[model samples]
Target: MKLMLKYLKRYPKLILLNILGIFSFVAVQLGIPTVMAWMIDNGIGNSDIAYIKKMGGIMLIVCVLGGAGTILLTYASSRISTNMIRDIRNDVFIQSQNFSHTEYNKFGVSSMITRTTNDAFQLMLFSNMLFRTALLAPVMIFISVFMTIKTSVSLSLVIGGSFPFIVAGVIIIAKLTNPLSKKQQKGMDQLNRISRENLTGVRVIRAFRKSEYESERFAETNDNYASNSKKLFKIMSFTQPAFFFLLHLAMMAVFWISSLMIDKGTLQVGQLVAFLEYQFHAMFSIMLFSMVFVMYPRAQVSANRIQELLDEEPLVKTPTNGITAENKGVVEFDHVTFQYPDGELPVIKDVSFTANKGETVAFIGSTGSGKSTLINLIPRFYDVTSGSIKIDGVDTQNYDLKALRQKIGFIPQKAFLFKGTIEDNLRFGNPNATPEEINHAIEVAQAKEFIENKPKKLQEYISEGAKNVSGGQKQRISIARALVRKPEIYIFDDSFSALDYKTDATLRAALKKETKESIVFIVAQRISTIMNADKIIVLNEGEVVGMGTHKELLKSCNIYYEIADSQLTKEELER
Candidate 1:
């Protein structure tokens, strides 16, 4: 909350106006019982109808001013609160884009989404309410108690004795409900994760007939969230009854004592009437404090959650004077060893390889053999666990991320497109790309056919993640998006898996001419996909067992030879 309060510094004038408004409201509220005390004890005691009418007029005007102040403060508080929340939400989202891969993975995707949305919203609720009511509540409560004690200290005993119970109730309920509310937010994360996963892979779940299992998983998460919510509310529910009961009991005691004092000729009936209104004021103030009690704990937890993400420092940083290069493509992996974070050993052990400018290098490995892992390291996405990767004879780590990524183009196995027109998605690779450049890239990636067939051609709209298009079409558009940039090095991580054999052959053939001056690396499962490359690597059990042309590997390496034999037909092998 302190972190959030820093934003209020931007709105000092507005905050002051809101404070003035709250003060005005509390002033009129406090004056109400005070004026009543005078009307009963002074005006009615003398039977001065004119004096009573005058006090009544003043009270009515004070009430109008209070109502006006209420509107002003509520409006001011809402505007400030909404703007502050917008700033916070923007910062959270922008910072997320800069988070290191490890940092992002640490919290998990679902948790980040939950924090950005639900947790931030909780903080907003408390901020809005506190701005409007928390400050005024104390003003009314303090002054009311002071007035009651000044009138008669003996009657003050009623407030002194029972207000403690209300405070205690708030404390106990806050302590119990707070942790449960935090747990509920975590459960909400799991629920969001299940929903997102199902939506993203709806086809696969349906194809495999796993709807029942997915439904069970979703229900478990929903029930957990519901149970946590119920626990928090059950505790929070104590405030209302406990407060009103304490107030009424205290009021009863005050009435009995006031009657005795009046009979004893020590207190007046009008004074007693005014004293009851002050008691009501004190009780309502406690109610407002109860609300603050309920809101603060939830906000504190939300603030903590948001702070964790903001405080996270990305593990990777560019050097003070990072290099920026303009050389032709030259990628080298020198004695590179790496592993997934939880793996027992390095998945790519003591691997050394180089691909010169304009050369094509392919990694051919079976599943779990670390081909994709090697491809990922070149761009510094998942950095090498040990050893160095270089581009243009300079260590990639020494290049600012902007300079390193700008020169390399990537096409992943799973194609993703944003919600926009085809032209908009294509322009993401190079926003300055001309119409001619976009059209040419589309032709090269074999996406032109479908794009041209659309009603709006390049302007055709795509739904989120390109759900409007087929898998192969989306892959082609993704490739076109990369090609439009004309990057120095293009890495295709099995980007052709969905294409038919004929399309795959055509795509590779087109690449030979269009990408002749650009280095190309591909990770492939099919022998035919990487067969025509200048050089190929075969990784197995975290080591490179073969590095040669297709014919040379067939002659020399058992694993590579077996792969080629198993994946190719006899007649094709003879050819």
Candidate 2:
């Protein structure tokens, strides 16, 4: 909750203006009852028509002033609350962008989305209420109580006597609902996660004929959320009615007690009526304060959630004073080891290798041999747990992250494209890339032919995630996007798997010539894809078992020979 005060401080002028507006509103409201009391006693009781008319006009003017003040108060609250929420939402999103892969996995995508959207919205509602009603409630109560004391000290006791009970009830209700609110928030995250999974994997669910199972899973989460909400609302339902009952009881007591004083001629009729009005105002103000207790516990939960994300320290820290190297593409992994945070064993162990300019270094192994993990370390996606990774004679950790990443063009195992034109996607790598450069990259990736067939060519619309395109087409476009950068190093993590053998062969042939000045690292499952590389690395489990050219490895490495034997003919293997 303290985290929110920083944003609130941004609008000092608005806060002052809102306070003034609320003061006027409460003053006018409290003044009207006093005016009516005077009219009833001095005007009607004394048989003076001019006094009645004069007081009536003053009451009408006070009503108009109160209405205007209410409008100002509402405007100020709306502007301040909405702007604060917008700033907070932006800050949360920006912080999430800085999160490393480890932090991302820790929170999960669905939970982050819920925090950014639903949780922020909850804070907005609470802020609006705080500015509009909660702050005014206390001030109104104090003024109304003061007026009651001035009118008749005896009637003031009614308000003071009822205060303690209302305070105790609010405290108890808040404590009861606080834990339930946290549970409700967690349930919402689960519901969102399941819904996102179902939407993204709808085709898989249909293919497996498990829609009923998915429905049941969704229903279970939905029911849990519904149950928590019901309990919280049921508790909150007691608040308004209970407060109203207390107010009515106090009003009745005041009437009964004040009548005795009026008959004895100790308290005037006008003073008695004014005192009753003040008592009502004071009790109603307390009721408004109670409303805050109902909504605030839930919003406090949301604020804490947002604060947790902001406070999270990323596992991979960016250097404050980082360096860069000007050397041509040269990558080295020296005694590298990596283990997942929750895994029992290291995924890659004591691995050492290097790839230099104009070289095509390839890695091949059985699935889960740390092929993708090895490449990921080069860009500092997950820093090596043990050893150092260097680029152009400088350790990767020493280089500024942006400068280091700009030197490499990496294509992940899965290709993703934003919803935009082909040209927009290509420009993502290098915004200043010329048309000629984009065309050259498209041709090298073997995508120019298909792109030309489209009526809009480079301007054609691509759907979100590039779902409208085939896997092979998306892969080619991803490759082209990377190429547009003309980076010093190119990494393809099984990027050719979706392409047909002929297209893969042609793309590789074109890349050989196109990337002659740059270093390239390829992770592939197919033996043919990597057989003709400058050097080949063979990994088994987490260890590298072989390192040599195809022929050299076949002669010296048993694992390489077995892998080759399964994928190549005897004559092909000998060649």
Candidate 3:
């Protein structure tokens, strides 16, 4: 909540103007009752029609001024609240962009989405109510109190007596709803997570014939969310009726008591009427204030959630004096070890290797053997717990992140593409790449034949997540996108898994010629995919158990022999 004030401070002049508008509105409201009292006492009582006419005209002018002030108040309040929301949403999104994988895991994708869109919207609603109703409530109450006191002290006491009861009711309702509001927000996050999973895994669910199970899973969260919302709204429903009942009860007492005072000649009829009018306005303001109390608790919950994300310091911070790579296409891992932030054991341990220009280094191991994790280190996705990874003889951490990444072309295991034309997606790697460069990359990646078959070629639209393309096609285009950069270091993280053996062989053969000046690092599960590499690193339980060529490893390393025996025929192995 305190953080939100930072954005509000940006528009000081608007706030000042809104304050002026509120003052004018309150003055006109309070003045109207007073003018009516004057008309009754001096004009009607003395039988002077001119005085009555003059007071009526003054009353009309006051009403007009009040209407104008309301309009100004609406405009200024709306402008400030909306602009503040826009700025806050932009900051939150930019902040999310800086988050590392560690932070992403902590918050999860669905929770971050909820905070960015839904939570920010909740704050906007609260701000709107604050400007239009919350501020006016207190000001109107104070002015009404002062005016009523001047009219008749006895009637003012009636209005004042009702204040404590209303305050207590509001306090009780706020306490009850606060916990429910927080629970509601958490429930909403869970529901969103379930919905996201359902959408992304819809095919998996249908393939497994688990549609009923998925439906039950969604229903459970939806029911919990609905129940929490119902409880919160039920508690809030008490606020309006309770406050109105207390206020009207006081109003009836004011009229009852004022009648006796008038009959006794102690108070005039005009003053009694004016006091009742002021009492109505005073109680009305408190009712408005109760509305604020009802809404503030929920907004406070959302504010805390958004603030949490903004306050998180990114684990990976860009250095102010970061250096660039002095030498190109050389990568080294010296006794590198890494563990996830929450993991009990390291994923890669005491592993060391190097791949220089014009060399192809491959890694192969069973699942959970740290193959992907080792390559992830060269790009500094996660910093090593011990030892160092260097590019061009300089420690990766010391190099500017953007400068370091520019030298490496990385393809993840799952190929993701944005919703755009083929040209648009390819240009993401090198925005300044020319058509000739693009065609060359497409040819080398073995994607030219398929791409040219399309009616639009490079201009063809790719759906979100590249769903319009086959798995093999997506993999090839991903490789071409990386090729457009012609980076000094190429990392293929099980990137050939989707390609048939023949296509995989062809792509790797063409890559050798195209990347003569680059260092290629490949992570593969298939023995055939990496058997021809210049050097192969075999990982076993987070440790490199073998390091050599295919023949060297087969003779010297038993683990390599068993892997080769399982995949190749006896005749092939003998050869």
On lDDT, the leading prediction is: 2
* The 10-residue segment with the lowest total lDDT in model 2: 320-329
What digit string (tens of lDDT, one per residue) describes model 2 on residues 1-575?
69779899999999988998899899898999899999998999998999999999999999999999998899999999999989989999988877878888999899999999999999999999999889999999999999998888888888899999999999999999999999999999999999999998999999999999999999999999999999999999999899999989998989898999889988888888778778888898898888888799999999999999989987776788887656757888899999987778999999998898999999999998989998998888888889999898888998988888889999889988889999999999999999999999999999999999999999999997687899999999999999999999999999999999999999999999989999999999998899889999999898999999999999999988999999899999878
lDDT, each prediction: 0.87, 0.92, 0.89
Clashes of 3: 0
TM-score, cand. 3 = 0.95
lDDT tens digits by residue: candidate 1, 1-575: 57777888988887988888888887787777778878887898899999899999999998999998888888889988888888889999988887767777899998899889998899889889888778778887898898889878999988999877777778888888888878987888899889999998999999999999999989988988899988888777767787788888898899899989999999988788778888888788879878888878888888899988888877666677788776857888899998766668788899999999778999987798998878888777777888999898899899988888899889987888989999999999999999999999998898888888999999999998787899999989999999999999999999999999999899888888889999999999898989999999989977999999988888888998788889898876666
Per-model RMSD to reference? 2.3, 1.8, 2.0
In candidate 1, how many Å is residue 156 off? Answer: 1.6
Model 1 regions more than 4 Å off: 40-50, 263-265, 268-270
Greater TM-score among 2 and 3 belongs to: 2
Give per-model TM-scores.
Answer: 0.93, 0.96, 0.95
433-484: candidate 3 lDDT, tens digit per residue:
9999999999988999999999999999999878889999888999999999
Q: What range of 10 consecutive residues in model 1 has the weakest lDDT sum?
A: 312-321
Name the regions of candidate 2 deviating beyond 4 angstroms: 47-49
